[model samples]
Target: MLVAMALFALALERLIYWRVTHRRARRALIDAWIQRRDHVSWSALTLREVWTRELLARLRQPLPWLKLLVAVCPLLGLLGTVTGMIQVFDSLSLSDSGQARAMADGVARATLPTLVGMAVAVVGLLFVSRLEQIIRREDQRLHDRMARAVEDAHA
Candidate 1:
């Protein structure tokens, strides 16, 4: 249940983040499309440097939440697991067949938290990896364009 909730939340948050970045990138791309043809000028150096920095800044915004969620999820799950184990041991001491069975059930349920934690971590890592990749790609593209523009201007 917790895993499913995390999945839903992760998807929603990521979608919102992507949309915002894509919107900004699209606007920049459109505005710079003409700049694309123009010879790389001295000004392109400043613009590329500044823009690259901003891109990296924006790319990092979503990470804290993802990282926190990933980190917290496992601990929460572990708590459930330990609690479940305690109940299991408690029941074993009572020597009641029914209580033992119930305790076993609690232990099984305890695993759900861990499962949710791992799931969240996996999902978060995937997002982190993809974000880094996009940031690198976009930065590289801007860098290349700047180089080309500068070269063209001198040529």
Candidate 2:
């Protein structure tokens, strides 16, 4: 659970950072790319492609790991659940099986891990979805900006 939360925190921090810094980062990236250009052509499609490639390259660094972490969090919780159930079964096998109190306690213990795992999965899914939205919005903005740049250069 702690590991899952930590991963969520890291993902949220990066997503927020990107949201806050995107404009400056985009400008800097465009400037850098412009400087390295061997030829000049006001081709919006070409520029858009380059921007997409760059965006993918940048996002590739952290997005997959964030997704993996989010995905693993639920599995970890499931593992906990499985382990808890095993213990409950073991306890049941060793003792008087008719005690409602013992059975209830075991059931509670078994459910706690599953509940926690579900909660982590929900939280992780929220963060991952939000980050993907942010990335998609940024990509669209970059595409529009590149189109405008191409028009301005041609003019």
User: Where is model 1 more than 4 Å wrong at Cα?
Assistant: 1-11, 19-23, 29-44, 91-103, 145-155
| lDDT top scorer | 2
Q: Summarize candidate 2's per-residue lDDT along 103-132 as a digit string, tens digits.
A: 778878877876776787778778778777
lDDT of each: 0.66, 0.71
Name the regions of candidate 2 deviating beyond 4 angstroms.
31-48, 149-155
Error of 1 at 123 (Å): 2.2
lDDT of 1 by residue, 28-143 (tens): 74356435554346676566566667766676666676666667767777887787777777767777566756766777876876787677678767866776687678677766
Clashes of 2: 0
Screening candidate 2 with a backbone cut-off below 3 angstroms (N, C-alpha, C), the clashing residue pairs are none
Model 1 global lDDT (CA atoms, 0 to 1): 0.66
